[model samples]
Target: MQKQAKYIFLITFLIAGLVSQAQVKQDTLKREVEVTKAYTPTISDANKLNSMPEIDEEEADKPTFNYNIKSQPVFSTFSVTPLKAATIETTPPIQKGYGLVRAGLGTYYKPYGEIFFNNLNSKNTVFGIHAMHLSSFGDVKLKGGDKVDAPFMNNEVELFLKHTIQQSILSVDLTLNHDAFNYYGYPEDPVPAPLLEDEQSINYFGTKQAFTKGGVHIDLDDPGAEMDEEEFGFQLDYYYFGTKTEQRENFANLTFNMRRPLTSGVGLLDAGVEFAQVSNITLPADTAIGKTSSTILFAKPAWYIGDEKANVTLGLNAWFILQTDEETQAKLAPRINANWAPVEEILKIYAGIDGAFQHNHYSKIAYENPFVKPDHHLKNSMQQFRLYGGFDGKMSKRTTYKISGEYAINTDKPLYFMNENYYFDAAYNPAPLIVDNTFDVMYDDMNRLKLNAEILYASSKKMDLSLSVNYYSYKMDKQEEAWNLPTWDATLALGYKVTEQLSVSADIYLIGDRKALIIEESGSLIPEDLPIRKSFTLDPAFDLNLKGNYQLTNKFSVFAQLNNFGFQQYERWFGYPVQSFNALAGISYAF
Candidate 1:
């Protein structure tokens, strides 16, 4: 019963404590409310803001700036010397023509005409054609009344074609030539007319004239901007010559050349082959004529060394020759050349040692001297060695100069000379008359030395001038002199622009004295005896030529040329005298 009561009391006490804690919590959580009134204020100045400001708003006060100016005296002086005037400046006229036609007539019944047409403006292909004709129908002063007319006529036609495609350039050329001349330099005969006529009939040397030549050439090359340089070329030519004495010659030549770089560096190789056949139909087939056919083959391998400032080329040129009735010959020659630029592009020194074989042909001989006798045998000339050195440099701002020297050794060098025998009517008048006009080929060993100098000056405008001089010395074995070769030669050329439409030019040529063999009659009773040969000196030659051109219109121009103004009747060959002073006036039309 006591435990029960204690529990009840404990329970009652816990309930009472809980009840008191709740009542205290309620008392402590009693809510209290505090309220405050909200105030709303109206714009009292609304009417005042709606009106404008009291200050004036239409304008503001004006602003101004002040300036101050000052002055000072200056002094200057002028020089007494005046400034030089500048040269007259003008641009050259543009030519709007693709074809040009030129025709002219001059003294000695000379007539000249030329026609040139070109379509070179095409990007891929170019074509051109040129034709020229020159003729002289003049009368020469001969000793006898043989109605000798020194007539000469030359006609030429050339066609050119070039094509470019993808790093390669190809070109082709065709040429045709016809040349005619008359033998009018025969001397008068002293014998009676009948006897002289009979002698002439026996050895009738008719007017030898006429040469016709046709040729074609083809070239294919790479200029080598991206690769090595390569080139291939070929040429074919046919020549026919006829003389009034029934002398005729036929010649044909075929030549091929190739060049290739062996490596991407400075190594190169070149090769060439030439085949030629010449026939002198006038000679009997059974006679011992030398070399109806000839063939030459050559090869060169080279190495290029050095840089832009200095360079050298070392090469070996090997060649072989094959001719009918002769043993085959082979040779090797050194080709060493060098160039040094001491002052960049302003001065250059060059030296070389070169050698080659120069083959002679009947066609070339007849071309060089039209009066060569057909009975003579032709031979080859070989240049065994040559040493040359030169230097070229700029002298001033507008002037340049060059000096060169050379020494060469040649074997079997050919020279032209008159035959020692003369035909005459010995039964009648014994005096020799009507000398032979035919030349013979003489071969000898020759040594040549030469020195050359040149200077050129070009002004800023209006004028240009150039002068060149060459001196030569020769020593020959088994020959009296080097026939027909000049020892000294000089040339002077001047160009002046007087006005825009008019221009003038002058050219002068000076040639030194030359030696020739003169035949004099020795007291001999036999008609076949050889004549006495004496050395004769020919006078020096001086030639001056003047030319002027006036452009009357864009398509038409007039030109005048005065040739040999000094009126010197010089003999270019042994017996051929060139004409004196001559003039030609012509008009050119372009389209």
Candidate 2:
């Protein structure tokens, strides 16, 4: 068996060696062959998959190996970018100082000063004090080239306090005013004075037109601006007005108003009432004339409908006006107002018909024209009816315009005229002076038609412009012409900023001619429609004003103003000529 295995192994080894040799010889030998056809390569079609793939559910064995990483900082040549930090909020802005002082001196011996004091930001309370003074002590050149002393002084002081309680606001105001002006008006042609009474004196006519006033006003309001709430308001006002001659007037008013919303706040019901009194206050108990006190009452009830885009107000005003002569005058008038905006923010139309009743208080007349005195009794004025229509709209992005017309029927319209002097000083209880150059007012029934147009433009940051024009036509019931009332008036104003620290402004004013009475005699029978007195037209008046301001520092500024630079000798009244070509320069300081 051993001998046979050895022989088989030997045979196998010999065969293997012979095969290897044969293969090497065949591969190493080079041979050439001729081909009848060229060789080509081709691929057979692949098998298609018809059924979708299915995932196996059988568990598979997972490898279990554990390794630990050494904690070390790896070295790298690449750079890393940093992230941005979070933001931080800043504080609120600082408030301005609470005091301002202004002082100036001007031509015509004018001295002007103003001061304001107020508290800084407060949570629930605000208080302020203001004082002002202006005066002119110089001569005015009349139309006939004559100079007269036309001195005037004005002073004002006011104090105000306001407080907030929950959602309501309460306010209180105290005001005082003292003013004086000399009645230096005289006709161009001097007229002869009639014989004086036993106790009359010419020097008394030189007394200044001086008056003093003090007032207190209080108000409480609940706007009810949030969440369909009711509104309520109250107002109380009282004042004392007096002249230098111990003649005085006292007035008091109390008002209450309430509003109730209806129909989900789409409409409102408004109701209010006012109680007022006017009394003549005189010392010594003997200078008083007629009734001392007069009462006035007003009841206002209205309904308001619609929203900001369109609205209508229907109301009635019941008035009870009493005269100083113990006469009662009562009237009930209708009030209606309708407003609509056809093109929101672009055009708005408003129309209204209303009437009002008010007392011709001595204080009101004195404030309107300090040079005028009353010749008749102080009565009540009534606007029987007033119809007005207007349209206001934005002309452009920075411009706005308004056009309006009004027609009114007025009774006891106050009109001023040159005093018809018959030297009737004896008729007055107090020894008085009589001057024909002085002015007096009368009451007349008038029908008036007025047309007005106004335009405004603003650049917000730099420039501003404004213009207004008015024309009036009057039909008087008893007078030959509307006395001392102009038929046309116009104003133009422009403001420009040259730089951040400098600004300039200009203004021009125009007034048309007015009529004056040219009567030679006077009597108690006045305000008649008869054409006994002749009439003449006064010259038109024009005025131009310029102003400049320069800011030197944040809290300091300088200002200069020029008034009546045209220097035209025209009268605002029949014979009174205003001062000409006045200039003022001043400095303002804030702290």
Candidate 3:
């Protein structure tokens, strides 16, 4: 009964809520709108415009490119400079000139001149001529305040010709030389005048030809044998002395050489022969100073073993010496030479052993020392052995070095000595007169040792340097010392290009101590000893030379030379002092 009542109450409540939520209704509210009447008007809405702005077409699209920029060096900024067209440089091309003439004057009344003509017949044949002259006429003051003039003059001329025929070459040379010198060794007031008849002249003529197998058109009968190349030459030398002293010499030589490859082709055979004749003639012949002649026949046969880069030659020199009233002498000397290239074209070593006979004559001696006595007895020098070794190598592309050493033994070697001949006239002269202010030859056995070194450096930028040194040791059998021979010598040369038209060079020369013999004067009278016994030593010497050249035009140039800048009064000879600081300037013209 209770449950039925609860359901009835729930049903009654639901019906009551439903009836209350669904029976309510509301009324609607309305608003009114007002309308206006349409009106028409006349047309006018456009406004006046100001003047149009002007347009700039040129500045419309401006470019941002740059035309001027600072130049930058391509190689290096701080060290290297950029190559560019120079504003102050206006150098012209240097044309080739064939002929040249040079002339100059310097202190001590010295004059120098040279002439060259090399443009003659420039076709297949070439011919040239050269001539030179130098003279000095001033007086030199001695240490004792005595002034004396030792005038000297030299003249030389040369003619050269070259012709090429097919594959062969032919050349000819002709030369003539003359010299004049005076022996003014004493004071001006007390010394007797010397004879001015001392003059020397020389003439030489030579012709040579180089012939190959093909050029000579040689036909071989045997196909296996090869025809050799040959060289032929002829030379004639004549020398004469014109003065109170009469001396003349004539030398003729004929040279022939032939070389051929061996059958194996690994070696070559070389053969050569030289025939020479020497004649000495003197006018008003005295037994002690008469005409004398000699003949020499030399034959050398060698074999070359190795390739072109490295080779060893084994040979012998056979000489036949024939002299007047003397037994014939036959000399046999061995000749050997070896060369090897440890590095091709870069380093090379060479060694050789050779011997020869040197002829001594009046003309040869006078040519070396014009003060030599004209009346000289000629003799021959025999070189028994000479051994030498050297090595040359390139340190860099522009630098090279060479060092060499040598040992030699000689017999009958000629040494220079001051003459002891003098005359004194008590009536005409106050001082003694030296008949000959010259050097005489003395024969002795000698041994020598030598060492030499050289270095050369050259750059592509117009600069070069060369240095050399030589050391020598000599021992004599009969003499106290090797007269006038230096123990050490050195030289340095440097060249630099200042500009396209200018160049300069510097040279340095050094000489070590040398020994010499001088005749002693005992109270204004020369001694009557058979030979001079007094001797002295010469101190070391140093010399500096500077030279420069400036080219004004292609065919004209100016040059200058400065010598002995150190101002050292060094004696080159026993009594003759070298020139002091001197300068020479000259002009050269070429056409």
- Candidate 2 vs candidate 3: the TM-score winner is 2
Candidate 2 clash pair list: none
Ranking by TM-score: 1, 2, 3
Whole-model Cα lDDT per candidate? 0.59, 0.60, 0.53
Candidate 3 lDDT over 61-81, as tens digits, reads: 111111010010011001111
CA shift of 320, model 2, Å: 1.3
TM-score of each: 0.76, 0.76, 0.71
lDDT of 3: 0.53
Cα RMSDs of all predictions? 38.6, 39.1, 41.9
Question: Which model, 1 or 2, shows the larger lDDT?
Answer: 2
Error of 2 at 514 (Å): 1.1
Q: Where is model 1 poorest over a 10-residue stretch in terms of lDDT?
A: 67-76
Model 3 residue 119 CA deviation (Å) reads 3.0
**Residue 249, candidate 1: C-alpha displacement in angstroms:** 6.0
Count of clashes, each model: 0, 0, 1
Q: Which candidate comes out best when scored by lDDT?
A: 2
